[model samples]
Target: MILRLALGLFAALALALFVQPQAARAAYPCPGGPGPGEVQVGVSGGSHGVAAVPICDRAQGGGGGGGSEVYYRYGSIAWHPDADDVWMEGSYDGPNTAERTALAACNQAMGGGCTSIGEWHNSSMRIFRDRSGALWSGWHGDGGVHSKKTLADCSAKQLLPCEVLGTYSSSKNRHLPKPTARKLYAVGAWVEGTEGFDSRLYIASGQRDAATAERLALDACTKATRQRCAILAFVGNGVIQTYRLGTGDQSATVESNAKRAAQAAQANCKKRGQACTLQRVYDSRTPGEFVHDFMAPAAK
Candidate 1:
C-alpha cells in the first residue's frame, strides 16, 4: 500500500509540472503560423494580457501597419502685360522647378519679358495690388492666410488702397477665376454737448471706402446724440488714433495717413504747455467704437 501511494504521488507531481507549462504556452500563440499577412501574438508581462501584432510583406507592399506616405509639390506663376498670356506651373518636386517651368512657359509664349509672381509648396498664396500699383503676396500653410493680416501687411509696407486680386491653392488645383477684391475704410468722430457735458467720441469702420465711412460715422453721431459732432479722423485701410493730453480742455489730434500725425499732435500739445499722451489708436478696416472722458481725471 505504501509503494502504491508513493507511485501515485510521483505521477501527480509530473502532471502538475507538464500541464502548467502547456497551459501558459497555449495562452499566447501566433494566431496564424509564421507567414506573410499573419497576426503575431505576444505575452504581456505579469498578467497584463496578450497583444497581437500584424506582420507585413515589405517586398509586395501589401500592408503598411497603419503607416502612410506623403508627397510634396510646388506651384508657381508668371505674369505678363496681357492677362490672357499669364503662365502657371504646378506639381513640381521643387520650388525652383515650378518657377523655372512657369518662366519657361511664359517666355516661350510671349518673348522674354516674363516675371515670376509667386511660388508656394503644398500650400496657397494670394496676390494683391495696392492703389500705388505695388504687388503683394500672402501665403497660407494649411487653411489660408487671414485677410486682415494680409491687408495689414500691405499697409505696413505703405501700400494704400490695397486689394486682393486672386488666390492660388495647390489643394484647390486652380486659381481664383474672378477678382474678389474688397475695400476697407476707417473713420473717427468727436462730439461735445453744447449744454454741459464734455467731449464724446465715436469711431466707425469697415466701410466700402473712406468718404462713405466718414460720412456714415458723422451722420450716426449727429442723429443719435443731442451734441454737435465734428470729424476728427478719416482714413482708408490704415491705422488711426487720437491723443488728448494734459489738464483742462486738453488739445486733441487725429493720427493717420502719415507718421507725422503723431509728431504734430505731440508738438501741438506741448505748445500748450502740457504733456501730451496717446489716447486711442484705431484701425479703419476694423469695425468698432470707443469712448472716454478726458475731463474726469482733471475733475478729480
Candidate 2:
C-alpha cells in the first residue's frame, strides 16, 4: 500500500510539472457598436507595471496576483515579458460624468476582471496617422487623442485651424488651435515692430522664393507704415536686388535697404546695426546663406 501511494504521488507531481503555463490574459475590449459617448472597459491609468492575473487562479486570493488594479479613462494597451511592466490602455468613457457603466459591463462579462476607471484630461498634442496615410494634428485627452474636450471637439474627422494658442497673460500656458491661435496672438502686432503694418504683414503659408518673400515683405511694410518699402535678398558676391512699392522716394528707401541688406550679406550678421558679437560664428566659415531681417525675433 505504501509503495502504491508513493507512485501515485510521483505521478501527480509529474502531471503538475507537465501542465502548460497559463497564458497571460488581455483586458476585455468594449463592444464595437456604440454612439459617440460609448463607454468601455480599457486599460486604466497608473498601470505601467502590473502582473496579469491567471484566469485559472482567480478564486484563491484577490485577483491581479497582488498587483494593484489600474484604471484608465481611455484605453491605451501594451504588453511585455515582465509582469510588473504589462499594461492595458483604453479610452475612459466618463469625462464629464463620474459613473463607469461601460467598464462595469465589461468586467461582468469577463468573470470579474476589473480595472479602476478615471477620466483623463488633455494629455498631449501629437501627430496621428489615419488610414489614408495623411498626418493629422490633435490633442490627446483621457478618451485618447480623438476624444472630446470642454474647449474643443477633437472627435471630428479633421483638425482644422491647427494654430498655437494661449501664451498671453489672459490665458494659461495652453496651445489652442486657430481660430483660437488668432485669439491668443497679441492684438498689437504679431511681428516685431512695424505695428501699423501688422494686419497686412501676415506670415505666408508654404516656403517662399526670394522674389515672393520680398514682395510679401513690401506688402506688409507698406500696409503697416504706408511709406515706400523695399525688400532685398542677398545673392552673394556683393550682388543684391530689392522689391519695392508705394510712392515713397526710391533713393532713401534703397539706401536704407542696401545698408540693411549689406549687414546681412556680411558674415555672422544679426540685426542691421548689431555687431558680429562672436568671433568664431559658424557663418564665418560657410559661404552663401546670409541672415536678413526676415522673420521677427521670438518674443521674450
Best by the lDDT measure: 1
Write down the TM-score for model 2. 0.17
Expressed as tens digits, the lDDT of each residue in 232-282 for candidate 1 is 555544555455556534433332333545665566666667776665555
Tens digits of per-residue lDDT, candidate 2, 5-57, equal: 00000000000011232333322222231234333322111221232111111
Root-mean-square deviation per candidate: 29.1, 26.1
Candidate 1 segments exceeding 4 Å error: 1-183, 192-197, 256-261, 295-300
lDDT of 2 at 218: 52
lDDT of each: 0.45, 0.23
* Residue 2 shift from truth in candidate 2, angstroms: 99
